[model samples]
Target chain A: MKSIKILERLLAAIPIMIGVAILVFLFVRLTPGDPVDLMMGSAGSVSQQEIQALQEEFDLDKPLHVQLYIFLKDVVRGDLGDSFTQREPVTDIIGRALPATIELAFGAAFFAVLFAIPIGVYSAVKQNSITDRLSMAFSFLGISMPAFWFGIILIIVFGVKLGWLPISGRLDYGFNFPSVTGLYLIDTVLARDWPALKNAVLHLILPSIALGMQLLAVLARVTRSSMLEVLRQDYVTLARAKGLREFIVIVKHALRNALIPTITVLGIQIGVLLGGNMIIETVFAWPGLGRLAVDSIFSRDFPLIQGVVMIYAFTYVIANLVVDVLYTYINPKITL
Target chain B: MLEIKNLAMAFETERGLVRAVNKVDLSVAEGEVMGIVGESGCGKSVTLLNILGLVPHPGKVLSGEIMFQGEDLLKKSKKEMRDIRGKDIAMIFQDPMTTLNPVFRIGEQIRESMRIHGLFKDVKGGFFKSARKHAEKDRAVELMEEVGIPSPETRYHNFPHEFSGGMQQRALIAIGLSCKPKLLLADEPTTALDVTIQAQILALMQKINQEHGAGIILVTHDLGVAAEFCHKIAVMYAGRIVEQGRTEQVMDNPHHPYTQGLLRSIPKMSSKKDRIEPIPGGVPDLAELKEECAFYPRCAKAHDKCLSQEVPMFDAGEGHTVRCYLYG
Candidate 1:
């Protein structure tokens, strides 16, 4: 029964996927830019014939319907087309960058969950205390601060002034770490390069913290409110009256029930974190899909833009689906 | 055995300090069933929660001594209270639907109290922890069966929501009795259930009270339930016990006007009349309470003197007490 529901959800996603493809295709094409002029290196200096030849060669000369037909056909064949500027398949470029983005997303989410839950639970348990007030103030600051501004501040403080860590890039030059997962930290560990791993982590800290700040704030607030509400429940009162330890009453009885809504917020935060990675990646000079999208937009790389949009939409859909599945596990009463 | 003396619990509300429970004294001997009967906001439930030390935030136990089995529970630390709570005293809430944790299975919840009090270690001498777990599971099933739950093994694994209201109350009772507590405080356990389910749950509770020899404090507004189930009945009015006596005496000859009103409100099966007599006025606001009789405004037989001076508990008859100026 559960598998059938999962299948139904997957089937429901097809129309959304198609809609994203058409929207991305039209949006990239309708934007005020020309890939032919970009490829010429000097706009209007190149002969009209050169531009025409480049357009014809890249099939940009085709009509909208014909182009969409060809794009959809290629998409059906598991092909996302090639990057116009790099002259390589968009899939291959994305595969290399995808690992970095995944690592950042997971790392930021891990950090947020690690600190947010404890802080939230503590704040709720000690509600109206000075600690609760202070932590809530910090959460407000985190929520209100933009990732771009936060990232820059981190860089200026830790990189420029303190000179404790690298200002940009995934790792230092001349490190020969094996590329196992394409994520530098993992690759360094795989190759047993301790210094490279340390360098990779040091680089990850600022961007991850900046990227996770909003998510952390949201998670903490949700967890706090959820816990406070759950703690008021009769079950929690009964658990306490049952003579269970305070820790068990709060954690086992209260937290487990409280976590359901927090998990939903987490899934949404994952998608938002991925979106924030665009600015974060650009700020850190990190090679990820969001940065690639930014670069593609500048150069009018239609295929790359469309591919990145499609992937982002796909990940968002999957994240929500995964959260729904997790909801069933956390609360068995939830059928879907 | 449980004894409470001068227990005054108050809540600081926006209006003012509302003394929810006022100078309440109660005692229940071992293996006895005592019922606290009152209308809503009369502090019946609050008195029970204060005994369990489960009063919610903004509420304080002003001055009280809850002596249970020779020790003062009020003087004990929170940690000590926790130790006494499930092992020695357990409480069942009013709403069965919301009382049990929805995320956990019935069997697990039933076993939780035992696990918390380390009943397995006491029974098994701390050997074969895995086997002890299985034994506990077996005991949980046994408890489910004991509470009259059908197909105990199968129903034990079900979540709280999967069970009906009556079944959920049974599961709650099962959990309450898991550790063999010497005292059980049930606060309107059947209020949320239908008439038939209410009867079943009451019967189940009565069975547990008899079989386990747990001193049960049943809090309810229904005088019929109190008369049927409890050995003694204490009628509360605005946080004070207006009248208390053995169940038969209280039922036969209610002394205080409030207790008399409560008995009159119960729908008699033999009566051909369609409408039952409800007490005239609502319970007085705890915030506006004064030293005079709280039931003065609502008492059908209130005299001028009843509104002027404080009414204290007066010995009316053999083993019966009534808090009224008329009793003097």
Candidate 2:
């Protein structure tokens, strides 16, 4: 079963890579920046020989189709090449930045699901009541406000005004950790660095809130509507007739069934989040792939752009594949 | 024995308060099968839902009482009443398609009520706790097999979609009969099934009743089914029972005009008739029927008196009753 899913993801990514390669090939030529001039420093006096050499160095002078072929071959071989702006391997930059976004994404998703499931369940169970109205109102506000905007609001309220938490990046300058895992808090905890862990938590709080708040709204509203429909099923009446406790009826019977759609929504949300991270990473000044991709696109760094788009596409495919497996487990009737 | 004395039910609607079941008196012996026959919206199912305490809100029992085993059930709290449901009194709904949870394994769904009705509430020994869950599964499998599943072991993990329509109804029956409740309310259990499956399910119900002595309230619109299985029957109109009597007598010699019309309307296989009788109009509006005999507007026998005044129910004979101006 696991192998089947891996095979499915591999198949899905192939088309996505082809589509992305075409886009990267087209967009790089359309953009204004001359890679040769940028590399040679337009501010200083440079010869045509130097310009031609630099263009050939990165194989920039190749025809569009050939360039696409080279990029595809390198991508398949797990080579993302050097960054035009950062002057480092694009993969190393991505590797260093991934944990920050991952920490934010997982933390936010965890918090969202933890709070949303209960709130959605209660709002659905107590539908048309004051509690339901309140949850609906809150969810609307959460979804409507952009995460970056929400982050700014949080920074002002919690960091600037209330002065409760630190405002920006992951760690305090002096803080050190044992590099056991890439995650800051986990590494600090493994190293038994309590102060570093505290600093990590403080730094992660606002970004987590920014991400968690949006997913919380999306998941809760979905949970509420989905549960409302699920609760109407005759099985719920059967559950009630059986004399199971109300909570048990909702949680054990209804919620899991309701989660079928919500699980799909979560997987889709992950895809959306990967794309939205460009905005989030920029706003929070977090050195994640989103920031890297944004800087690469601005500099017309075609190779880096190709790598990021393909990776993001691949991430989405894997997430959907996982959701598919989960769907099968939740509903035994599902064939694939 | 379960006895309902002067039971009245009303729904608070947008227009006004409408009485659904009015001042009704009924009793079922420990081992009797009673049928409540009525057209749609005649409150037969609602009455059963009321008795089960499964009636939706804003639809309330206005007055009277439901006594189950010498205890007034209406006065009991939800928590206390839950203990009685599916343990002492179980119910199977009309549509088998909707009856069982679609997402659950057939065995798991069967054991849900079993576990909740305190089927495993007993057996305190430490060794028994681990064995009890397994015992519940064993019992579920046995019930499924008893209901005539081809292979209980393989089918136990299968869901509702895996079962045929007949099998689904049978599965529903298996679930209802699982705990062997003292009273079972089967509301239109055969309505959604085909004629063959319907006959099979009706026969199954009769078998369960004769073997287990589970008193049943078979709420259905089909007088033929009621005539065949139920000993006594209640025929309702709008929201009230217009005629009720022993099934043999009622089907053979129906007293009320509404009852007579309903019986004549059925297409009988024995009769060599060119055309079956068709009752001309639909059931009366429930919200408008509180003022008079609900069938008055449609009944050929109706007069000015029938329109102006409410017709009270009268005892016609031994355990027989009819509500009409003629009887009144």
Model 2 chain A: worst 10 consecutive residues (lDDT sum): A35-44
TM-score of chain A of each: 0.94, 0.91
Query: In model 1, where do residues sit more than 4 Å from their true spots?
Result: A1-8, B122-128, B272-274
- TM-score of the second chain, each candidate in turn, equals 0.96, 0.95
Per-residue alpha-carbon lDDT of candidate 2 for residues B74-186, written as tens digits (9 for 90 to 100): 99998998888777888888888877888888888888788777687674545647667777889989998887777988888889989987888888778888788999999
Taken over the whole model, the C-alpha lDDT of each candidate is 0.89, 0.82
lDDT of candidate 1 over B1-328, digit per residue (tens): 8999989989999999999999998999999999999889999998988888889989999997999999998899998999888789998989999989999998899988888788886555445676778878999999888889999989978999899999999999888888899999999999999999999899998888888899999999888899999999999989898888999989999888888887788888999999999889787889999989998888778889987877878998897999997888
Best by DockQ: 1
What overall lDDT, based on C-alpha atoms, would model 2 receive against the true structure?
0.82
At residue A67, what lDDT does model 1 achieve?
Answer: 93
**Model 2 Cα lDDT, one tens digit per residue, A233-279:** 87787777777787888898898889988898888887666656777
Candidate 2's C-alpha runs over 4 A off are A39-44, A189-195, B124-128
> Candidate 2 docking: what grade?
medium
Alpha-carbon deviation at A177 in model 1, angstroms: 2.8
